[model samples]
Target: MILTLTPNPSVDRTIAVATLTRGVVQRATDSRMDPGGKGINVSRALAVNGTDTVAVLPVGGPQGQVMEDLLRAIALPVETVRISQAIRANVGIVEPDGTTTKVNEQGPRMSADEVAALLAAVDRAAAQGLEWLIGCGSLPPGLDGSFYADLVRRGHAVGAKVAIDSSGAPMAAAVAAGPDLIKPNDEELEELVGRRLATLGDVVEACRTLIAGGVGCVVVSLGGKGAVLVTADQVAHARATITDPLSTVGAGDSLLAGYLHALTHGADPATALRTGVAFGSAAVCLPGTEVPTPADVAKIDVEVVDPVDLDLPL
Candidate 1:
């Protein structure tokens, strides 16, 4: 089973409007809410395709209750650690033209005891034979960037492959622990490498730097242009044919879910790249933060090529 840890979870409320005008009243055409946080979203997406997964997070206050209710309705297995502060709520405004504007909260703070309890839960889950242990999203207020790094170490000790999708110092710390996989978009990778990757060569070079530093694999998401997967042995580029895009929220999480699912199921890296891109593209066509189903995966036309041109355009 795949296990995900989201230290800071949220209730994501999405509202649809014809147009978003500043300093004026607007009527909502429709609205929906879902469980938020990168790891949580990954688990939700995995459940969409009948993958066995569980989410571990801290829940508190009224909003946390709402989050639990939503997860229950979707039949997601979750392990919770109680916290004192109320979990945050995020708002998203989506226009008919597929424009999305978001307002996010910093989320609740976790005390030392609370953080330790959460890690212990991960340890217990890993002991139960978890194939993948994913540490995602940002570190909450009181926790240092070393939180994800600790997760990488703990997961590795239990023989569980660790995959991380986070930014800033937390990501840097996790990289130092040599995670099995990392999923970073172009912007996040650029920040990590401290360079301007204006070409595919530059991007691949940066990913290779990570591989050399002991990271087992690096997957770079290039938004609508598709994604590239890099390992010590091979490199592959994959793009999918998608039409009528909707909201782009949770697309990256879907990509990671698909990639990890394929890897755990014994698919080759190239095939995993194709499945990851297809899942991401299918996610972009759905409204709000919804993930793709099996039908969406079958409908995707994916193109994957190995030994990509080093000097190709970005």
Candidate 2:
């Protein structure tokens, strides 16, 4: 089973319109509300695909109730830690041209006792035959970046492979803890390394440096340019077949879910990359933070290419 810890989860509401004019009223074209935050999205996608998984998070107040209700409606298993402060409800406005404007609320502030309870919940979840523990998304106020670092250590102590998807100081600290895997988009990758990764080789070298520092593996997502995977033994590239996209939210989380699902089932490096990118590509064709199901992933054509051009422009 895969376990996920979303320290700050949300209820995402996405509205669609013909165009977004700054000072003018607009009529809606469509709308949706889904469970948000990176780790929660991954668990949602995994549950849809019949993968055994559970999401552990902090929830409180009415907004938190709504978030929990949404997850239950989708049958995503959750182990919620009750917090004193309410979580957030984030909004997104999507245009017909796939332009997205998002406003995210600063989620709840947890007390010291609440933080300890949250970690204890994750520890309990990890004890239940969990294979991977994914710690993701931005840290809420009052929690230091070391939160993820501590979580990684706990997961490792339980023999679970920890994969982190976060940014800034939180990401830096987690990487230093030597996570089993990390999925950093181009911007996050550049930010973590403090350099301009203008080429595929530059990205590869950056990931290699992390591996040398004890990180097990790194996956650098290049948006439309596809994704690259770097390990101590191999560096490979995989690109997805493009499609008319509706929204880009939750695509990266879907990629991580697919890759982990395949990996735990013994798929090779290239095959895992293919599945990961396929799921991500499929997610872009859906609305809101919708995750791609197996059918959606099956329709996407992606394969990790050999003789990966190290100098490929990102």
Candidate 3:
């Protein structure tokens, strides 16, 4: 089974309008709400794709209850640690032209005890024999960036592969812990490497640097251009065939879910990259943060190719 941890969860409110005009009254054509968190998104995508997965997150206040109810309605397995602070709510304004503007909250503050309790839950989940442990999203306030690193260490000790999708100090610390896999988009990677990635060669080099830092593999997402997979043995680029534009949000999470699902199911890195690219493309073809179904992924053509010999800064 795949286990995902989301320290900061939220209730996502998506309002659809014809256009977003500042200082003007607007009416929303439609509205939808769902559980919103990186790991939560991954778990939902996995469950929808028929993967056995469970989401572990901290839930508090009325909004937290709403998040839990939404998860239950979808039949997704969730284990929430009750907290004192109310979970945050994110607002997304989607225009008719597919432009999405988002306003996000910083989420609730997590105390030491609450953070400990969440870690305990992760330990319990790991003890239950997890195939993949996904530590994703931002660290809640008052929690150290070493949180994901600790989870990676625990997951490795239990013989479960860990995949991390986070940014900033948490991501840097987790990389040093040597997670089995990391899925960072181009911008995040650039920040980690402290350099400008202007070309595919630059991205490949940055990925290799991360791999050299002890990460087993690195998947650098390149938006609509697809993603790059760098392993100890080879580097491969997977590109998605875009059909139509829908919503780009949560596409990266879908890609990570697909890749993790494939890796845990015994697919090679190349195959996993292809599947991830396809899944991400499918996600972009759907509205809002809704992940694509397996059938939708099957229709996208993902091309994988070997990169030419490139110079390395090492």
Best by TM-score: 2
Query: For residue 171, what is the lDDT in candidate 2?
Result: 95
Query: Which RMSD values do the candidates have, in order?
Result: 1.2, 1.1, 2.5
The predicted structure with the larger lDDT, 2 or 3, is 2
Distance from true location, Cα of 158 in model 3, Å:
1.5
lDDT string for model 1 (1-314, tens) is 99999998889998999999999999999999999999999998898888889999999999989999999999898888898999989998998766899998999988899998998888777777888999999888989889888889988888888999999999999999999999999999999888899977799899999999989999999987799988998889998756677788889999999998787788998889888898988888888888889898778888876568777777
Candidate 2 is scored at a TM of: 0.97
Question: Over 4 Å off in model 1, which ranges?
Answer: none
Residues 1-314 of candidate 2: C-alpha lDDT, one tens digit per residue: 99999999999999998989899888998999998999999998888887899999999988899988998898889889999899999999998767789999989999999999998898787778888999999999989889889888988888889999999999999999999999999899999999999999899999999999989999878888788999999988998767578888888999898888889788987678888898888998889999998898888888667889988887
Q: For each candidate, what is the lDDT?
A: 0.89, 0.90, 0.87
By TM-score rank, best first, the candidates go 2, 1, 3
What's each prediction's TM-score?
0.97, 0.97, 0.95
Residue clash pairs of candidate 1: none
Candidate 3 residue lDDT tens string, 1-314: 99999988889888989889999999999888878889999999898998889899999999998998999899898778999999988888888666789898989998889988998888777676788999999887878989889989989888898999999999999999999899999999999899998887898878888888899999988886788888888888888767566667788999998887787788988888898898888888877788889898998988776554344221
Per-candidate count of clashing residue pairs (backbone under 3 Å)? 0, 0, 0
Task: Locate the minimum summed-lDDT window of 10 residues in model 2.
Answer: 240-249
Error of 3 at 223 (Å): 0.8
